[model samples]
Structures are given as structure tokens and as C-alpha cells.
Target: MAQVLEFKLPDLGEGLTEAEIVRWLVEVGDVVAVDQPVVEVETAKAMVDIPCPYAGVVTARFGEEGTELPVGAPLLTVAVGAPAAGGPAAGPREGTAGGAAGSAATSGGTTEGSGNVLVGYGTSEAPSRRRRVRPAAPVRPQAAGPAPATAPTGPDRTGARNGNHEGPVPVISPLVRRLAREHGLDLRELHGSGPDGLILRADVEYALRAASVQERAAKAPAVTPAPAPPAHAKAAPEGIRTPLKGIRGAVADKLSRSRREIPDATCWVDADATELMRARAAMNAAGGPKISLLALLARICTAALARFPELNSMVDMEAREIVQLDHVHLGFAAQTERGLVVPVVRDAHARDAESLTAEFARLTEAARAGTLTPAELTGGTFTLNNYGVFGVDGSTPIINHPEAAMLGVGRIIPKPWVHEGELAVRQVVELSLTFDHRVCDGGTAGGFLRYVADCVEQPAVLLRTL
Candidate 1:
């Protein structure tokens, strides 16, 4: 007699009710080992490749590509147990489940439910069954049995289904559930260290760290887990309460916080950037990546910060101290479909023009692709927002959180300016800098702006600054 096993979609991240199945790595009739990648799913944060947790001959693929399957939905099936007699002896082969690996399956097809199991026998725990796609509408409750399993805490718990209680109410600790949910670790796979096989938070954390190491050693890079949306994230029947759970949501929250917390003062100046334009054109002609006016503006900001260290400080609201940094890490406001992401280029004060150009190029590309790491989004000493690309004149940009100052660059246009004592059409750009008054005085801001203006007027001044 053959034993069958099913693989359901495990929670891939926190409270993720559904996930878009991007691609299937395995097909029907393929013999797979435990922990081998089976499918790739695109969540809000990144594309995650899920690993198979069973070793056997694959029999079916329940969820097709592009389908948004809920957690605990059957993803694939396998038949464990003996092979058909007179055909081939199917016994446990080692190196797969720590149980067996055998020759690939010969015949199979993608199906919705169980089908055509054979006579061979292989052994493992019975596969966890899948829940129905949609739960029946809740009737008026007569009586309650027990509380259901809580959602896991991390990004990996994305595909977790709604409440289902069938097993003996497991004694799940709060932190364990939080760790499992946050990291997307499947609680079912973890053997508990607590009494009565109760999994502890430490056990889950250990498993996560160990598995991450193994994954890295196996050449599969661990993806940055997107933070979970709030628990109260729900859609009302009358109006939608979409969770700000992804990159766009994050950007919105950060911008809102900055605007709320920072006491801002805006200062504006206009500068002739004719030489800066010429330098940019020369760089583009010499096989550079066509670094934008934004890059030039960023370089100037770095120089300005060097002259006035107060602008490079952050208002420490919690400690009521002004935290200052010795180095400049200038963050550029990169606009993406997921709203705006500010990816910082560190040590901008130390890098030359070409290096700054390349770093900004790579960072912005990663931002647009939604592949930027959490580290890339943090640790900026100052920020620069370029509205020039959008043909805007100038507007005060709100400073990013904690950071005391932000510089906004406006569009450069050919305008009449005093050049060699003659009013001639020259490239002119507007600059707006908003600083927290608590950290810097007005004189410092004015001097810094003048320094930046001088650098923009003569781009070669940056060569000496570097």
C-alpha cells in the first residue's frame, strides 16, 4: 500500500492572508528532497522562494501560477510508500527526508485533489491537510471551544490562514508565536524545547538563525523581510482600510512622522549652475551613467554639511540631545511605484564625483526594483530631494526623521544672470533647505547655503573639497 503526503502553503510572512504564486520550480512526477525550493511567491516586500518540506514523488500542484492562494492551501502532493510490484521495488532511499531518495517519478499531472496513488510504500508522518479555500460564513455562535492559533509575528508568516482549531490546543507562548510570525518560521516544523513539546521563542529564533546560515551556505541569499502591517489592518464593509504594509506604506508613514515631529525653517537661494551643467555633459560624453543634476546637488550638500556640522545632526527627542555625526551620509529621494524611497550613499563627503555618481545610480536602481535592504534605507546624516526632474521651481522639503536638515533642488533653466558684468542667459537653479531650528542657528544655515551655492556656481570647487 502507498502512503501519500501533501504540502500546504506554510505561512510565508506575518498575517499575509494571500500570496501571488509567481512560478513553480517543480512539476508533477519529479522526485524532490526535503528543503528543496518548490515555488517562488511574490509578496509585498520581495520575491520569496519556498522550500519543500517533504521528500517523495510529486503527484500534484494545487495552486497554479498567478493564483493568490491563502495560507494552508495545498500546494503540492507526493506519494510515499512502496513502488508497484513487478515494476520496481520502492523502499526508503536515504538522503532525502533523512528517509529516502529514489529515482524520479515517471507519470503525473497537475490536479486539484488527490489522484492515482500507486502500490509502493514509503513512510513519514501524515501530511497536514489543507483548509478549504474560503471559510463558511460564521453562524451566530452557540458555544466556544478554545482560542485558535495566533498569527506568527514576522514577514515570513504572510500566507497564514485564518482561525482553524483541530489539534489539541497547543500551549503556544506569546513570544514564540511572535517570533514565528515575524520571521515566517513555520511552527509545525519546530520541535519545542519547553515542557510537553511546547516550542519556545528561543527555539524558534535558533531555528531561524540556523536555517538562515544553511540557506546562505547553500547559495540561496536570504531576502529582506518586509515589516508586517498593523494588526488592525482591515477593510471595513463601507470603506477600505488598506494596510500600509509595503514600501509605499512605509514611505507614507515616515514622511508623516517627519512632518509632525520636526520644527522646520525653510531658507531659499538661487544660484547660476552653468559650469555644473557643462561638467555633467562632459561626464555623460565620457561614458558616464549620465549622472543627474540631483547628483551635483547632493555633492554640494555634502560640502555644505562639512562647513556646518550642526546641519548634520539629528534632534534626539527621546534623550533631548542633539546627536551629531562626524561623517556625511547623504540620502537621495528616489521615487518608485511604491512611493518614494530614500536610499543613502554613505561617506559622501569622502567620495569623488565618479564614485558618488555610480553609487547613486546603483542605489536608485535597487530602490525602483524594490530590492533595497533595510540597511540601505537607514543611517543617513542628511537628505536631498530633487524636484528638478519634475519641472518644479522650488519647495521646502520636509527633513527625514531624526535628521535635522534636508535640501531641495529645483529645475535649472536658462535665465538672465550677472555673468562677467553682463546680463546673459545662464543656467540657474533654485535651492531650498529646511533645518530644525533646535539644532542649528539661522546664520549657520545661511553660510552653508552660500557655500553650496558657490560650489554649484563653480562645480570644480568640489574637486578641492574632495
Candidate 2:
């Protein structure tokens, strides 16, 4: 008889706790080889393909597309020792018990066990023969009355009374529960729309939004007049909503934490980048591999950090000590359609302009394609944000948390300036430094920004450090 093995969602690393099913590659009863990708999931960091470790006939799939499953949740179940015949399993024969045994006999004849170790299962050992059993039923959310008929509701109203409910709440992520508790919203009062009626973060957020709207409506007077419509009609419906669950949510959480925890301050300086622009043009003209403007700025940043190491450090709140890093793992912010992502270049201080240019190009392409791995998106010791692409003059950037500072580069445009005691148009750029005040004071931050400005004003200053 074929033994059915369950495959749970593997840990995609980088502290990701859950992933949403982007697409399913296999269907129930499809024959699959070992290490074949069965599903593609999108985590907060990136999209990952999950491979099935068992080589057999797929008997069941757990979640549908667009459903989010927590780590260790069952993804699918494969019946090992099934017939090796291509296509779905055949119906049971006269001697077979419920056709499962016959399907196993047919598929198991030629299928070999996979030695791969997935998130929750290890296939290194010899296969054990066991009868296929049906999985236990999942906890279903109690059906609630009709809500606004706009979106899905959460738990029922009386289900949460006195916390005396018998069964466990059908919530998946702890984050959802925490959010409801923080907002004083009862989870049991809303209905869940996820598979098996599992509560999702979006369901809670929608409930909260609905409650807030109702409360405001109650407070407002009933005699208010409607305003005139604008020239262009709204594209979306009145109650159209987008969930902040994936990359957008991750960015929101990080930025919020940074604001809440870091004592940050911003300093700005206007620098004449004429020399830097000229230097870049000259290098590209005489270069084997063309150097990028961002690369030049990054080289200058590494040199500046060397001179003022205080800014290249993070505050260890638990130890209550400032941790100064020796190597610069440089992170550059890239804005993509999905949102803003920072891809890190490892040991950036040691890389030359050519290497940095190549690395930046590779990472930028990957970022645009949404193919950057979790490793490439994390472990940034320092960040260099060039917001000039947006045509903005300057901005006080929020420091990527745990990183002490972020250097923001503005658009270098032609502006009237003093050159050789004569008025002339020069390429001027604004540089802003947003640093964690806990790691260093304004004086240190000023020194770092000044060094960077000096290099921009005179590229020759960077050559000495190089």
C-alpha cells in the first residue's frame, strides 16, 4: 500500500513566518518527481518555489491561490509507492481497498523515494510502509450574520462571549490576533474568508475600517450636504480596498518601528557636484567597463565612512551598546512597482567602482523583476539612498532600522554658483544625512556629511583615499 506523506510549507528563512500562494504547479492526482516544484509562494521578501520531496502521486493540495499559509502549515500530501504511470492515478481494482492500494501499486512500481529534506519532513531514511489515512478536519470559523455585504466578516458575535468558546479560533497568524487585541476589536465578532474560514490580517483590518467608519458616521450630524463631484470620475468603487499584507506591509512595519524606536535627526548640505559629474564623464570616456554615477557616489560613501566610522554602526538595544561594524555591507534603496526595496552589496568597502557598478546593475535588474532573494535584501550595515531619480531636490529619509544612518542624494542640476571667484552655472546637488541620534551626535553626523560634500565638490579628494 502507498503511504501518504504530508508536506508543510518550508521556512523560506530571513525570519519570514508566512507566505501567500502565488500559483500552484501541480493538481491533486498528478504524478510528480522528487524535488519538483509544486507551488510558488510570495513572502514579504520575495517569491519562492517550493519543491515536493516525495516522488509519488499527489493526493491532495491544502490551500488555494491567493491564500496565505503560515510556516509549517500543510501544503500538500503525496502518496508514495503509487504507480509510475504518467497522469492521474487509476480507479481501484477488485482486489484493491478503495482503489488507493491499486493506485499505489501502479505508481510505486517505478517511483523512487526522494532524499531531499523539506521544511517539515526528512526523506533521507528508508521509506516506511503505512496505510493512507484521511487528514483531520481543520477548525472552521462559526458562520456569522450578514455584515455590510461589502467584504467578508470575521467570527460570530456570541462566539467570543466570556472567552468560553469551546474550539480554538480559526486564526492563522499571531499578528492578526495581536492587531485585533490592540484595536480592542473582538476577533469572534467578524467572519473569516480564508480557506477553512481561517482569519486573515486583511479580514481584521477591514473590520476595523468598517467600525471606524460607522463610529464617525454616528458622530457626524445628519444634515450635512454632499459636495460636488470632480471633473474626472473616480476609477475605483467607493468601498474598493487594498490589503497591506505582503511587501507593502513589511515596509510599513519597518518604517513604523524605526519611527517608534530610533531617535533620528536629519542634516542637509548643498554641494557643487560639478566636479563629480565631470569626473564620472571622464572615467566613462576612458573606461573599459562604464562606471555608473551611483557607483561613484557609493565609492565616496565608503571613503567617508572610513574617515568617520561612528556613523557606520548600529545600536544594540538589548545590550545597551553601540556596535560599530568593521566591514561595510552597503544597501542601496531601489523603488520598484511592488514598493521600495533595499538590496545589499556585501563587503562594499572592498569593492572598486567597476565591481560596485556591476553589482548595482545586477541587483537593480533583479529588484525590478522581483527576483531578489532574501539574502540579497537583508544584512545591510549602511544604506545609500539616491532619491535624485525622482527629480526631488532633497528629502529627510527614514533610516533603514538597525542601520545607523542613510545618505540621501538629490538631483544634481545646473545652478548659479561661485567658481574661481566668478559667477557661473554649476551642477549642484543636495545631500542629506539621516542618522540615529543614539549612535552619534550632530557633530559626528556633520563631519560625515561634510566629507561626502567635499568629495562631491572636489573628486580629487576621493582619489587620495582611493
Candidate 3:
């Protein structure tokens, strides 16, 4: 007998609550191996491939690609255990599952799955079978019996105004419960629009809105409703609307929070980068691992941060303290097809030019390929935004939220400038530093920018601290 075991979407760490399905690797009736990536999902942070822990013939798949599923929602079901004679059991072996149950499926050993899964799958229970996608028109939950509903609490649980009989509430997310509790709305009275009887946040909100409408309607006198707009006005020009979700949504949220919370200030300077460019060209010509210009700039940044440590920190507003970190995890902005992602290099203060170049290359490749992990996307103490690649000269970049400062570098172009007192064409670059005003005043910010400008003009200035 083949026992079908269902797998749910695991809790991807870093407080991520949901994921939008991007692609499915396998189909129903296809055999999959244990730990083999089954689906690619786009969370708010990054793109990740979820691997199933059970090895068997895929019996069923849950959602279509691009469907947004909450954590713990059913992903698929796999048939485990032995088949009678020459069924899916005798097919080509994909790979074995963890232990005994896999042994039975392949070698007629024992039953029961190994339950050994990845790190994020910690105690994630198998979700009940509820596969239908919610249609736009509201549908009431169909149950084996009437799905048991919890009665409303507090003083509002009186007779006709209260919820139904008390029992289990089919809600998975704590956030949904919190929203309902705060509004004093009865979850049992509303029809759920989720899989099975699961009460979602949208359902609660809809119920609240409906109640408000009814309350207002009851107090007002009956009147004729307004007519629809004329045909000419209805046929007005329309525009393409994109849903703000996934990485784009995350960027929108972080940037908005940064604007709301951080009291930021920007300062800029133009530097003759003739020396910095020469230093990089000379380093490559000498033939040791080729160093990137970004690496050299990062080296200068670390050196400048050592002199002015206040810039390499985040302010704790609630604690009323400016928390200065001892180590620097430098984040650099990389624009990709997906969106703009800032990949961080850990312990950047400790890396040399050669090491920094290698790490930057690795991260940039990952960013372009959409394979960067959440860990690589976060934990940046200070950001370095080189907007020069776009062929622009200077921009006052918004601070990457929670981080205190971001340094922007503009395109290095040949321009007429005074070098050693005579007019000449020099490689000039603009450097802009944006800092949280709460962390430091104008003097500290100015000194930091000046030090960076000095380093760009004379590369040897960096060597003193290196």
C-alpha cells in the first residue's frame, strides 16, 4: 500500500511569513528524490528553492506558478511505502529518502517516513488537504459538518450579536488573529475565503467593513442609489498597474520606512580621481590577482570609517543610544533584472583589496542570477552605492534603513580641472555621503567626506592606515 505524505511550505527564517511560487520543478506522477529542490519561491527577501525531504512518486501538486502561499500551506503530496507488484515502485530510482520508509519504498524494508528535512522545516506540520484556489466571488467554507467556530469573547458575546458555538478556529497566522482581536470582530460569523475553513486576515477585514456599512445604512433613511458614470467618462485612458509584491514590494517598504524614520543629511564633493584610477591600473599591470576599482573604494571606505567610527553604525531610537558596531559589514548596491539588491560582504573591514574583489565578484554574480540568500542580503552596517555605472554624476541616495549612512560614488569621467596649478583634463568623480542626522552633526559628516575625497585624489593617503 502506498501512503501519500503531504509536504507544506516551511517557515523560511528571518521572519518571512509568505512566498510567491515562481516555478515548479516536478509534475504529478514524476518521482522526486529526497532533498531535491521541488519548487522555486520568491519571498520578500530573495529567491529560494525548497527541497522536499521525502523521496517517492509525486502524487499531487498544490498551487500554480505565481500563486502566493502562506507559510505552512500544502505544497505537494508524495506516495511512500511499497507498491504490490511493478507499479510506480519498480520505476527508475530518483534517489532514496532518509531512512526506513525510503528503504521500504525502494527495498521493501519498513514503513513510516524519516521526517528528516532541512533547517527551516523545523516542526512544520503537514497541512490538511484543501487545494482549490479561492475565486473572486466569495465562497463559504464547505465542511464535513458545520466547521466548529469559536464564540466571540469580551462583553460583545450577547445572544444574536455574538459568534457561533465555541470550538477550534481554522486560522494559521497569528497576525490574522491579532487583527480580529483588535477590531473586536467575531471570526465565526464571517465566511472564510481561504482553503477549507481557514479564516484569513482579508476575511476579517471584509467582515468589519461589511458591519460598518450595515451600521451606517441602518441609521440613514432609504434613498435611491446614484447612477453609473456616462459612457465617455468610463472609457477614459487606462494605465498598466503592477502589484507591489516580492522584492519590489520589500524595496518600497524599506525605502518608505527609511524616509519616515531617519532624519538624514547629504554632503558631496568632487575629487580628481587621476591617482585612484592610476593605482588600480598599476595594480592590475603588476599581475597579482586583478583588483577591482570598487574594492579599492571599499578599502578607502573602511579606512575612513576607522577614523570616524560614528558613521559605521545604526542608532537605537527606543533605547536612546547610538549603537556603534565594532566590525563593518559593508553592503554595496547591485541592480539586477529582479530589482535592486544590496549584497553585503561580511567583516569587510578585515578584507584586503584582493579578497574584497573576489567576494564582490561572487556576490554580484549571485545577485544577477537571483540566487543570493537572505543572510547575504542583510546585516549591512554601512552601504556603498556606486551609481556611476549608470553614467550619472552624483545623487543624494536615501539611507538603507536601520543603517546610519550610505556613500554614493558618481561616474569617473575626464573633465578639465586644475592639477598642480595648471588646467588639465583629469578623471573626476563625485562622492556623496548621506548620514542619519540623529547619529552625528554636520561637522562629523563633512570630515568623513573630506577624508574620502583626499583618498581619491591621492591613493597613497590610504596606505598610511592600511
Best by TM-score: 3
Which is better, 1 or 3, measured by lDDT? 3
> Arrange candidates by lDDT, highest first: which order?
3, 2, 1
Report per-prediction Cα RMSD to one decimal. 16.0, 11.6, 9.2
Error of 1 at 10 (Å): 9.5
Using lDDT as the measure, the top candidate is 3
Q: Which parts of model 3 are misplaced by more than 4 Å?
A: 83-237
lDDT of 2 at 445: 95
Q: Write the per-residue lDDT of candidate 2 for residues 350-374, one digit (tens) a residue.
A: 9999999999999999899877777
Error of 3 at 183 (Å): 9.1
Q: How many backbone clashes does candidate 3 have?
A: 0
For model 2, what is the C-alpha lDDT against the true structure? 0.74
TM-score per prediction, in order, is 0.58, 0.69, 0.75
**What is the Cα-based TM-score of model 3?**
0.75
Q: lDDT score, residue 268, model 1? A: 91
Clashes of each: 25, 14, 0
In candidate 2, residue 31 scores what lDDT? 85
Model 1: weakest 10-residue lDDT segment is 117-126
Higher-ranked by lDDT: 2 or 3: 3
